[model samples]
Each structure stands twice: as structure tokens, then as C-alpha cells.
Target: MTINCLDLFAGSGGFTLGLKEAGIKTKAAIEIDRFAVETFRHNFPKVDMHHRDITSFNDKEIKSNFTGVDLIVGGPPCQGFSVAGPSQYGKLDDRNNLVLEYLRFVKVISPNMVIMENVKNFINGKLPSKDKVIDVVTNILDKLGYDIKIEVLYAPKFGVPQSRTRVFVIAIKRGCGLPFPEIHETHGPDKKNYITVGEAITDLPFISSSAGYDDSPDKLTYNEIELSTYQKMMRKDGKGIYNHISMKHTPRLIERFKHIPLGGSLLDVPLEHGQRARNGTDLDTKARFKMNNQRLDPSKISHCVTASFQSTFVHPVMNRNLTAREGARLQSFPDKFIFKGPRTLMSKSLLIRENREHEIGLSQYNQIGNSVPPLLAKAIGSAIVKSFKHKVNDTRRATHEFA
Candidate 1:
């Protein structure tokens, strides 16, 4: 029997991609964003796609359209619940209701397993009513005959090169006992498996700061055609890697990047801001560094690859920031998995640093940054599959325990 699934708020299909890798095929995906939907269709062509907002999407259609969904894999739009976006006391709106929509489908479909991913803080995040979202979800899942299990997994520890932390809430049918997903740890603090930024991108061609979109293959700087096991797996059947380009940085931003050292944070820039702020040639400015921004540390695991990472993370050796593809690589997306949309996913936030500009939706960077690393997804998917065929013993014991 095939384990069918549905991906909700399927941003660029990252969760779905990993679920597919682990034998769970998506019956259909619902995404409102045009750019993300295009990328999803381009990659997973056969599956049904819906561009309607989930809130307004007729709930009855879910049952009428599909059945026997062993799993429902996806999270509601998290911008409202995210600690980075807004405080619980503020910004309450319809977006928060999307999670309720997710539950509505769950109530109807009653999938055997439901896996939801969200920002780590979502576990305890609250709505304006002062009701904890996690508590509400736990209550709902319990009443729905699901045994709830929650774990916050860090990407770096689970084969991803970057240090992004996400919360995975797994609920299995009540008869299954606790649903513990097996973890495939590729890197860790003690284990050398933690992939470094350099190891992740060393093989890709060096891109200049002014680099634009290119549809050709990147020139390899290193010899020996044999790729690292990580590279070989990620490069499988990849053709002209699309969306591997750089976002145009302002001249002032370039000057800012010059003063920041590798792996430093925003607090790393030079202190001399007023005098000769625009000039890079000033001796005082050149020497007066006070920690400007975060550049990738090639030797160590990368920090979180966020939509604004390019604005902050400078290349370890190179003077420029990571291109879209390099950012994708850091997120552990294979080369074959192409990202299609505007070359840059610019939003109102960019206006803070850039001129007035606009786009239909997310760029490759946002898609990648916002995605659950496929490696992490694959691990979770594989574990879920295993629970069906074997005892729940496949569970990886807690490495770094968090309540």
C-alpha cells in the first residue's frame, strides 16, 4: 500500500521533496504564491496543484479530491507565529487562522500520520487570545486520535551544512503509540559529519560580486573529477543549474562587507561610520573595523541561511556573498532541483537597503532559506516509513535534549 500525503503551504515543495524521497508521494499540493507554485509544478509535474488560499479553499474539496492520505506534510504560513516576524501580543490576523485550516483538513482526512514543520519558537508561540498554539494543537491532535510527538531538530546536526533550527511536530494514529522519527545524522559537534560551508561549495565555480544569472555549468576550480559523496548525491542528474546568480549589492553594502571578517556578525563592522563612511580608501576607515556582518566560515558549519543571508554572510575566501545556488547548496538542495522565478525574490524589506523594486514572489534565496533542508526531510520521511514496517525502535536517541 502506498503512503500518500498532501503538502500544505508548500513553499517551493521542500517538505514534499523530502517526503517523496522517503517513499511518501504527494497526492496534491496547495500553494497560493504563483512563483512557488511554478517551481513546484516544474519539479513535480504529475501531482495536482491548487493556487487558491487554503483559508478560502473549500474544505469539502479535500475529501472529494483525494483519499487514503497516510500523511499530511506541511505547515501553515508561519509569518504571524514566527518570533522573528512579530510578537505574540502584536500582528494577530487571518494568517494565524491557517493553522486551524490545516486542522480542518486533518479532521476530515484523518491521515494515519501527520508531520508539520515550523520555526522552533512556534512550539510555545501564542495567539492574541493568550492561548498557546502548541497547547491547542496538542489538544486537537489528541482528540483526533493522534499520539503527538514534538522535536526541534537542528539542520547542521542532521547532514545540512547550515545551522538552522526547526521544530517538527509528528502525530501518529493513537494506536501507534509515540511517533518517533528516525534521524540520519550526517554531521555533529563530536562527529565530523557536520558539513562545513567550504566543503559544501568548494566544488562550485567562484562567482563575482557583480555576478548575474547564468544558465551554464559552473567551472570547477579543483582537479579530480570524483566528487565528494555529498556532492555526488546532490548533483545527481542535474543539468544547467538555473537560478545560480547573485543579487546586486549596493556599493555601500560592498564597502560594509569589506570590513567584516569571516563568520562575523552585524556587530563586526568598523566603528568609523560618519567620517569617510562612503570611502573604502580612507586609512582610518580601512583600519577602523568593528565587526560589520556575518561572512560564512568555510572551515566550520554555516549559520542559518536566511533570505537576508546574502546581505550579511560574506564568502569566507571570496569578497562577495553567496549566490542563489550557493545558498541553495548550503540548504542541501541538489543541483538537479532547479528554482524558477525572478532571479531575485525582492520584497518590501529590500527597500530598506535597495531602491524601490518589486517581484511576483519569493526568489531562489527565499525559497531555499525558507525550505526545510531536503536532507532533514529525507531523514524524517525515512523514519516515518520505517515505523510502518518495523517497531518504532528506529528512533535516534536525543543528541542535544531540549524540553
Candidate 2:
């Protein structure tokens, strides 16, 4: 039997896209953002969609549409729980409260399984009372009669071009004994060599941060690397890339990009610029946050790419900010996914986001700052399918014995 999925907080349908690739069917999706909703609907024309706030939704409404979904999958808004934000796990973060809404849906639909993805920091610390994330998450699942298994997964380990680390929780019902996904491979056969920024974007065509073209639906090509495995897999249909949003950088930011090295950071730049060149907090000395740690090396992979531009997100080679296409590419978004809204939406988002210090009223850039890269989502989806298949086999055996 085909596994059915109900995707909540489905941003650009990244989780949905990966689940579909893993052979699960998305019966319905609930998303709150207008841009995300339009984009999800455009790509997934066949799936039913709910475009309203999840808080207002009721269990009876969901039951009316989906009776017994096999899986409930989503990455709820993480701004509240994210380290990038205030890092407040439980209090004052309204977004954090929404997780219970997800749990509520699970209580109503009682899906056979649940899959959730979030930032790695979620595992690094506790909620309140110093409780582990698993403790909190499992408590919710336990009430729903599901057994949860979790792992902090790195994307580069699973064939994604970028090095994105995220926490994934996979929960199966009590009777279903599903094993966790084993780490199959690491980047470059050694612990030292990780998926580099160069490997991820080297093949794409060069567009300066200052350039913009009228919206065109025709698929386009950038460079010789278009046929590479990553590109080919992303463009599964063999059509050219489409809807790759590119933004140019200002002249001043362009000058700053010239100072960053392939793996160097803002510290390498001059002290007069008022940029903090120090490493992260001097507490952990290793290069944990170095991936995109405020450098503009187009030759290197970006740190966690955000939808917001306030971070030191200039291009490594160009003087301008990273274009929307570059940001999307770093996030593992497929080229064909189109974003609606005016061009100024991109500009205003970056401007308002770059300066804001507080957690509230984040620009669109900050809103997308810590999204689960879609490429990583696909790998997690693969693992979920693997676990699900194993459970299906076990259930078959038990059924046969009873018969």
C-alpha cells in the first residue's frame, strides 16, 4: 500500500518534494505564507492545500479531509527555537507553541508515523528545566502512542553538495519496530574533507549580485557543469533550470567580497570596516560556524543560506550580496521552483532584515534564515522510506501468523 503524507508548515514544499521522491503520497499540505503557498500549489498541482494559519485550524477540519494519513511531516517555524534567534526554547516564542498544533493534528489523524526536521542547535541544548529535546519530543509522541528515534544528520554525509547539519526525529507506532538510518558515507572518505562550497556552486553560470532579468519561464543554462550529478538530479525531467532568482550586490558590499578568501572570513579583512573578525564566542575553537561565517567567496560553499540578507552574505567573488538564485541553490532548492511577489519584496526583505536585532518582525530573509536545505530533506526522506519499508515487512509477517 502507498504511504500517505500530510505536510504541515510546508515551506516551498521542500519536505513534500522529497517525500514524493521517496514514494510517499502527499494527501494534503498546510502552509501559512502567501508566497510559499502559491509556490507549493504551482509545483504540486494535484495535492490539496490549506493556506490559512495552523493555529486557527481544528482537528475536525483535518479529519474531514484526511482520515488516516500514514505520515505527518513538517519543519515548524524554527525562529523561536533557533540559535540565530533569541534561543528561547519554550517561553515568549509563539512559534514554539505551534509545535503542539502539529502534535494536535497527530492526535486527531493518528498517522502511522511522524517525521520532523529542525536546526542542529535543537539537540545541542535543552528546552526548559534542562530537559533534552528528545525528552520533550518523545513526551508528545508517547501521548500519541508512537516511539521516536532521532539523529543529528549532516547533509554532506548523504550526498548533498552543501554541508548542512540538522536534527531529524522519526517516530513509529509502538508495534512497529523500525531501525534508524545508518550513516552510509561521509564526504571525501575522511573526517577532515567535507563537502566544499566550491563543489556545490562551481558549475552554475556566473551572475553578479547587481544583475537582474525580467521574469522568464524558459529554463536557462549557466555553465558546463549543468549535466553534473547534482544538477541532473535536481532537474530530474532534463528540462533546463527555471525560476532561479538572482540579485546583485551594492558597490560597497562588492568591495567587501574582494577581501574574503576561499576559506577565510571577515577577520581577514581590515579592522577599519567595523566587522567582527573574531571566531564564534571563543568558547569552541573548532571551525563549527566557519561554513558561511561572514565571508564572500563564491568559490566556497555558503554557510547556512538564509532568505534574509542581513548577514554578511555577499558573494565570494562578486562585490554584491548573494543573489536569490545563489541563496536558493545553497538551500538545495530546485531551479524550477518559482517565487511570486514583486522584485521589491526581495529588496525590502533584505533591508529590514539586515539591521533588526530582535526576534520579532523578521524580514523574509531572516524568516528563511534557517530552513532545512531541500537536498538534505531528500536524504532524510530516503531514510524514512527505508524505515517504513522495514516496518511494512514486519507487519506482513505478523498478519500471516495470525491468519
List, residue by residue over 1-403, the lDDT tens digit for candidate 2. 6778899888667778767776778999997777677667877999989888888777788788777688888887766566766565344354666666788888888877788877776665454444555567779898778877887777666655455677878777776576664435435465445544555555555666545443553534567753545555555552454434455545644565577665576555544432333752322223223433365444444565645544446555545555555565566666665544333343444556786433223233433444566666666667767777787898899999999
Off by over 4 Å in 1: 88-94, 176-180, 189-191, 212-214, 218-226, 250-252, 272-292, 349-360, 391-403
Error of 1 at 320 (Å): 1.8
**What are the Cα lDDT values of the candidates?**
0.75, 0.63
TM-score of each: 0.85, 0.80
Q: What does the lDDT read for residue 223 in candidate 2?
A: 72
Model 2 TM-score on a 0 to 1 scale? 0.80
Highest lDDT: give the candidate number. Answer: 1
Compute the lDDT of residue 285 as modeled in candidate 2.
Answer: 28
| Local lDDT at 240 for model 1 | 49
What is the C-alpha lDDT profile of model 1 across 267-296, one tens digit per residue? 565654212436554335445433335677
